[model samples]
Target: MSRFTRTQKILMCLIGFFLALGLLFQGMRQASIGDIGYSVLSYLKYGLIDYPLTSIKNFASDFSNLWKVQEENDYLKEQLSMTENYQALYENAQREKRELQELLNMNESLSDFNIISATVIGRDVSYWNDQITLNVGSNDGIQEDMIVVNSQGVVGKVHKVQDSTCIVKLLTCEDKSNKVAVRINFQNEDTGEDAQSEETDSASRAESVEGILESYDADEGAYVVSLLDEQEVEEGMRVVTSGKGGVYPSGLFVGTVKKVESLENQLGQVIYVEPLSNFQYFDYVSVIEVN
Candidate 1:
């Protein structure tokens, strides 16, 4: 009871050591087996369980990344659309600015010719004689009989002038009262010189003189001559103001003749013409004032 014998103590010590060694060896063996099994699972289940799990995790991350990318793409597209709209507006403004500059240059070139610059403020489309109202008026030294010509050609005459505004009759009015003598510039194919209309010829009221009115410049002698003799004027013929009634200056540019048509008159021929200036598109003009 007080103390064990030396032999007994030695035996107990031996048993304890063996037991500890056995436990350590068993734990090592189990760990080795677990590591071997894990290695096998990685190799065998690569395409099935383990690999599929890894792929699913990667796919989830990719889906999140894709959502962010799509959002960014949509934002970029919206920005591009806005930029395009802005570009179109900028281009339109630039075109208008260029046109205004051209008009200013034309005014400078016509300094020798007395004229007034007028801005169109109103348009009358309903009346038989469509008229355009200008910002200028009698107060601005504008008066009736003043000829108005835009960048294209002759627009009309100042029919009425108020204190602050004036009315301009367009050139196309069909009142049978307004008439301007237009000379066609044709090269006599035989003479090689400019074709001349002899006013001395017998004045005969031919059949209806139907021709598209075109603009002519008196300076260059570009205008529509008569094609009534069934003789179509050659292309590149110039038309000019005849200075017959002094309606427009003799040398101002109207437009070039593109084609001609003819009708038989009882005494002479009637000619049809196509004007070169696109009158319908111009927005500004110059009013010719005779001193």
Candidate 2:
């Protein structure tokens, strides 16, 4: 027989490859042939590559939102701080306005003297209640013995005067030289039944009585005024400067009678007068230079 050729051998191998391809397609047809390849490729892409990338993107977005929330909180805190500062400024302005109005009224009543307005610049820490320093001095016509006052009542007198500052010795000092001649005006209305035991049975109806404020009673927070003579005095009596020695002016309100005590060894009664001015609230004052 003729020897088998290379061309026939190649033909037989190709036919065998076709037969295997045909059998694989026949098996796929039974299980949705057209979609199986696509489904496998899609599952591998989404499950391994696409799903992981999507999770990473979502995590980054969540981080960004958290950072934004923190930024918003910081911004709110800054706004609140500014609001508090503005409120403090407004309150200070209102306080200054009220003080100015009160000073205006006081100016009208004390028109007789050369009024020099001043601000409290310094304090005597060693003797806080006894002394304070003012912003006015010799240049401002503030001299020694010049009366110092606020809207409420007498503050003190200029003790030492400098070129632009003066030290005021307060009337509330314990010194014996703090004496002021005072006149007491008894009230016509009843001052309730809780009056001190030293009050007389009869409502004191002397048009007015006179006393000398000699010292300060720290325990009672009152001024101790000694009567010139044994005179009937009661609670609710208005006390004012008598202008006798001319240190303090006439009709300057000093205080009101808080209590009265009769001295057994002395001939006069000790009157306790509550000061008209709040000693704790001193900011501005006026120096009275007798024109």
Candidate 3:
């Protein structure tokens, strides 16, 4: 309408009027006038009324389905999130129960001592393997040099204490200053003595060797136990605290010999001991003392 001139628009209207007249006359000649009128009415009913109504109905149905689908999706997502949370909680509870069982066994083995159980609450990032912090502190009868142990063996002594927390110095500390008096319980028994042995432990009849666990090889994950003098330290020998120097108690498990080598200038034998304690993963420990 905008592009057409006023005269062109008038001409188009006239031509449409003539074409309608011709069609009307032709229909009137071929069919009854009433039938022609009825056909036009039928076209108007379908095109103007039924088509629009059906389209609106279909659109409403599709929109309702889309809304229901969105709601179901949201509901499923929420359920999945809740399930994940429950699964995590269940796993944590199982782990706690297992740790408690281990601690119970440890307590039975150390029934002679007054033991205070504590959770490992923190670790120094710079000295992760060397030290761990416990939830127990001086307020809970804790003090410096208190012996800390897990189900496996000696963890470390309490290095520092506060009102609510204490730091433990592990045997994996960088320096050799924290040496333990240890004895190697080896299977060097004579064949005749072994046949006569009644003890379940193979080292029961074997001769033992005393040494100092003064050095640690971090890369090898073993302790360098330097004997007083050159002696044949055999592999697979178990080491335990010797209870000398009034430091560690007798028979507390230390580690086993991974290998044995000679010291500098062959002055003594260097026994590499792999500890029983899993240094990477300990959650609970006990601070022990003589009753």
Candidate with best TM-score: 2
Stretches of model 2 off by over 4 angstroms after superposition: 1-56, 124-126, 190-205, 264-266
In terms of lDDT, which candidate is strongest? 3
TM-score of 1: 0.55
Local distance difference test scores for all models? 0.65, 0.83, 0.84
Model 2, C-alpha of 7: deviation from truth (Å): 36
- Candidate 2, residues 1-291: lDDT per residue as tens digits? 757688988898999999999988888786685588789999999999999999999999999999999999999999899899989999887876777678768878999888999988888677877889899889888889988887777877889999999999887888888788989876655466755443574445366887899988878888999887556898888988888857888887888899999879857678999886556566788888865
After best superposition, candidate 2 residue 85: deviation in angstroms?
4.1
Reference-based lDDT, residue 269, model 3 = 70
Estimate TM-scores for all models: 0.55, 0.76, 0.74
* Candidate 2 minimal-lDDT segment of 10 residues: 196-205
How many pairs of residues collide in model 1?
A: 18
Over 78-167, each residue of candidate 1 has an lDDT whose tens digit, in order, gives 999999999999987886676667767766766777878888888765742357889999888898989887764565788999999998
Q: Tell me model 3's lDDT, rounded to 2 decimals.
A: 0.84
Determine the backbone clash count of candidate 3.
0
